[model samples]
Target: MALAQYARLGVISRSAPGLVLARPLLAAVPRSTTTSVLRSLASSARAGRFASSRREPGMVPVGRRTRELPVNTIIKFVPQQEAWVVERMGKFDRILEPGLAFLVPVLDQVKYVQSLKEVAIEIPTQSAITQDNVTLELDGVLYYRVVDPYKASYGVENAEFSVAQLAQTTMRAEIGQMTLDRTLAERNQLNINIVESINTAAHDWGIRCLRYEIRDIHPPENVVQAMHSQVSAERSKRAQILESEGARQAAINVAEGHKQATILASEAVKTERINEALGAAEAILAHARATAQGIEKVAASISDSPNGHDAVSLTVAEKYVDAFGNLAKQGTTVIVPTDVNNVGSMVAQALAVYKNIGQARETPTALPKDSRKQAILDTLVPQQDTPPARK
Candidate 1:
């Protein structure tokens, strides 16, 4: 009776070959058309043979053509950092976010799955020629994330594989702009450049190219040997330059030291000569002053004497006799006057001459006024008459 009513309402049709039942018809098809209706119809057609497929034992079949199930069945549960793409009637409809999700079985099937977590893709190693025409083998790894699930599922066939290929192409292009030395020395810059390039081109692919790292770069063995030789030569060049600089500095320092020592020695000599001359001058001046003091005292004493002229005459005669005796004692040769008494007369004449000399240009020192000094001079003058005591 239900099948007749459904048939009368134009909900079902029959196929020609085996009277197969067709799907129920609706006045207006829904945007989210459920595809489970077809599965149910098919399941009912094969009911007896596969009734136990998804059925629990000990449960009897509720109807002859189909088994009844709850109409508003709630399907729940989603995973963390996972996105599920839903399709209605075999057409992509919507994407399911993380956490619990509802689906009308078969109709809202998960068509595409995308992980929201970061993915690391290894770019295959390949040879690239640098700007300086140096060929090198390079490999790298790329990190990316699926920012948009809808585009990730529909924009590209394989996200990891496509990103890897894009990263490789970008890396090669970036490497081609730099020399081999720059590539090796500035690896971090190279990585950033490649990542930027990949991200710029892969923006539409729902991928956020986080970072790209060049794992390794290998040059030829012959190039390695050449680099080693170049390094050694550079080191030797720097060492020679340093050594020459040190030698030059040492020579300059030695010359400066010699100049300083010579200047000091000359200064020392000049100081010594000047000090000696000062000493000699000081001695001469001191002697002159002492002599002048003595002359002043002697003149004053002479002026005070009553017999100053006679005293001076006697002193000169006595000095003459003493000198004659000293010459006879100093050497083996001796001279004797023809008349020894004549020596007294000669001394008297010499004294007269000395007294005239004293009056002419200079005054002689006066004898002391003491009686003891006068007595000695008187005795000395008398004793000089006997000039005779042999040596």
Candidate 2:
């Protein structure tokens, strides 16, 4: 039994040269305990030798190999706004939501870990040509979130990178369709268009494009200078138009003022002429009335008084003399009456003329109209002598 135990323990085996020296130590030990211990060690050595003989190239020994457990391999605690995609036996299986989740050790693997939180991605600056042949450098930021973990994991590889590239392409296409002026003026609209386009193409990617914002736009230096010059020219044109309008309005006002002044002046002159004519007419009427009144008074006195005719004749004689005196003082040219010294004869002639006029007025209807005018003329002016008639 002792020999058999020693043989089983490898102490007596010539194949184990190193164990040959432990035979005495094995003899001192209890047979049963030593046999059990030695049997286990011998079996372990046989296993090691067999494994080494069949080991693949570069394979580490079992004792020296490291055993590390991957995260979420068995039990996992998911955080808020996070999702884990699990594949069973390398196939689609289920998703792990937030909170505690247990997974089959080797059968289930968390293939993709996606965060449900919003993410901001920056787009690198790139050159794009507008419809107006203007080249511009544009950069922007994109906001996105994963809505479905299954699609986010399997629908598209590298979701963030793909979405960012899609954003850049969409922006370029949108900018290309518009002119430089429109692109600059419609930045918000441009961003909306880009987001819409990206969302359309990435629908199956399980990513929601929340918004896109243009951070900066850089145009060529010459284009910027040209825009500045255009703005200046437009402002100057507007100013010129306003100035011309003002000048034209001022000229019109001045012409209107002059026209009004001229019309007022004409109206004043007309009014003045009308007033003067009215005054002249009134003066003539007043003089005629005073003369007629004086003549009527003189006729009434001549008819009422007994010595009226004689007094009138005497006054006429004196007036005739005063008229001659005034004519002599005025100038040297004077025609002396034939009977200038015969005052009594002149008075008699004046009285005779007054009596004739009184008779004509008393019986105006008795004489024909022609005879009456002839009689008055015959009395006032002397008749020429008749000449002999020639055969």
lDDT of each: 0.65, 0.73
> Candidate 2's residue-wise lDDT over 4-105, tens digit each?
465565543322211222233444567676556455545544454222123222121111231111222355677678777777767989988889899763
Q: Whose TM-score is greatest here?
A: 2
Candidates' RMSD to native = 16.2, 15.6
Q: Can you give the lDDT of residue 255 in candidate 2?
A: 100
Q: If scored against the real structure, what TM-score would every candidate get?
A: 0.57, 0.59
Candidate 1: tens digits of C-alpha lDDT, residues 222-241:
88898899999999999999
- Residue runs of model 2 more than 4 Å from their true location after superposition: 1-70, 302-391
Indicate the TM-score of model 1.
0.57
- Total clashing pairs in model 2: 0
TM-score of 2: 0.59
